[model samples]
Target: MLLAGCAGAPPAPAERPAAEPAPPPVAAVPGVGVEERDWLPPLFSGVEDEAHYYISRLPDRRFVTTYGGEEHPRPWYIAAERLGQIGEPAIPLLAARLESSDEYELMLALYALMLASQDPSLMAATGGDTLELGSVLDPRHNAENLALARAWWQRQGWRWE
Candidate 1:
């Protein structure tokens, strides 16, 4: 006769807990379909609205300070300054402006993009080899600038956060 401990067959294997489901895939564009406007406080309705206001006012001429100490129109400087300060959050909105037929808007958007991202390559893409604001804003280079800016946006815009 078999011993009491050895008589019974080996016990069945213990059951394992069910495996967890895989997480949902993330969107290629981080904020693709969400209503970003609703998330902000009432003072500023949305980033787009704020960006539009500043972009609409981008100056045709650069602000200059006189030797006598008189400052040029501060509003002009302020608009570009604000856009620059908005940084990456302002990128997609600025990129949308790239398709406009208006050279002013296109240039302003690209300029703001350069300022926002602080990416010298964006300015370089506009054919401005230097970081000087004047070189990037020069209207003489508009066609080449727009073409290159558009190409850059095509390759890199969606990748921005």
Candidate 2:
């Protein structure tokens, strides 16, 4: 009789399906492509705001160097360093800028991403060994770098926390 009661009792609740992993986060800015004019500069007034200031100045290509170890006056380099110092908080912003059509903006964003994440893979993917101002400026190198960057972002950007 107890066995019959046990049989009559409802089967244990079906095991809940495992929760799906959450989708990766997207960039704050919507458009995947760049705009006609530089969009990042107007976000901040000046140096008073560190992140915005650096982000705004990232496209400035006034001075650049052939290699990393050597010092350069490029505002983009300084901005990349500053943004790197800002760390994870800067990832999404830099990620957004990766969509930029402007080569400088895109490259600067990639450089900042390399710094902010400190991921050797990103460095490796984006030509860390050959990276330089000239390589960034060269059309062939730029396309290669951009392709690698976009691929990296697709694969790892969302999971980069």
Best candidate per lDDT, number? 2
Off by over 4 Å in 1: 1-42, 45-49, 59-68, 71-75, 119-134
**Predicted structure with the largest TM-score when compared to the true one:** 1
Error of 2 at 53 (Å): 1.8
Instruction: Report the Cα lDDT for residue 55, model 2.
Output: 81
Please list all clashing residue pairs in model 1, or write none if there are none: none
The global Cα lDDT (0 to 1) of model 2 is: 0.59
lDDT of 2 by residue, 1-161 (tens): 34434547677888999999999964353221122124344454433465666787778774233333347532235667667766556767777787688877777777776666664554565454322233553434666776666666676665555
Q: How many residue pairs clash in each candidate?
A: 0, 0
Candidate 2 residue spans exceeding 4 A from truth = 1-49, 62-76, 119-140
lDDT of each: 0.58, 0.59
